[model samples]
Target: MAYARRLWEGYRELLASEEAYDPFLLLEAVEEWPVFVRALRRAASKNPAEALRLAKEVWREEVPLRVLGVRLPATKEAFLAQVGLA
Candidate 1:
């Protein structure tokens, strides 16, 4: 545990030294959000059911919720609304 903690601290220091990278981008949710948005947008026109499925899958996952510190349904709905699919 100590070794892992030290490594994490070192990583944080390195990340802090770099101004271009937002550390939050390391989170799965933040990193994948844009891609998901684009995918959902494209899917919405061609396959609404598939887009809905993807949204539900993302909603059920814990990573985005943990990173965003938000709960289900509301968070999922907001994202869908942002893309104009809901």
Candidate 2:
């Protein structure tokens, strides 16, 4: 979990610092971590729009409740509404 947190922080930092960073560069760093790689691929398989909404929530430091699991909004507008930004 600590490693994952560090990776997430590094990812955000890289995005903030680079105008045109290559995601593949990050991928190479985690190639040996199959569990992390699998989870990443699973998230990547999700609908892009919904994924973006969830990402927006995280980026805004408003991560959704995780009592059972995350319940992603069906649309961007719904996400905004849930976050009280609509």
Candidate 3:
């Protein structure tokens, strides 16, 4: 699985527990927000604080460093060489 997907799955799992999810605030959150996309549900089983922090992180507004994970093809010259075009 992709690292991002794994991270997100972990975040979801962590938030399911009472020790992590803020029922009060969670209920108030807008489901349509983009913040939901950044969530991660992973944490050490014994660390509730970190779990809550991760949840809050998913709730907050922050610019992401990555929007997509892609492996681009080689440069034009490399492609041409491979195809005998050079």
Candidate 2 lDDT score relative to the true structure: 0.44
Residue 6 lDDT (model 2): 48
TM value for model 1: 0.49
The sequence of per-residue lDDT tens digits that candidate 3 reaches over residues 1-86 is 13334554544454454464555434433231233333322232334455445434433312221112111124534422322223
- Write model 2 residue lDDT over 5-79, tens digit each, in one string: 444455446445536545575454345334433343345355445434444644453232221133445675665
Per-prediction CA RMSD (Å): 12.0, 12.3, 17.0
* Model 3 alpha-carbon miss at residue 35, Å: 17
TM-score each candidate.
0.49, 0.30, 0.23
Most TM-score-accurate candidate: 1
Model 3 TM-score on a 0 to 1 scale: 0.23
Candidate number that wins on lDDT, 1 or 3: 1
- The deviation in Å at residue 67 for candidate 3 is 13
Scored by lDDT, the top model is 1
In model 1, which range of ten residues has the least summed lDDT?
1-10
Model 3 — which ten-residue stretch has the worst lDDT?
Answer: 63-72
lDDT of each: 0.52, 0.44, 0.35
For model 2 the local lDDT of residue 43 reads: 51
The 10-residue segment of model 2 with minimum total lDDT is 61-70
Tell me the spans in candidate 2 whose CA falls farther than 4 Å from its real position.
Answer: 22-86
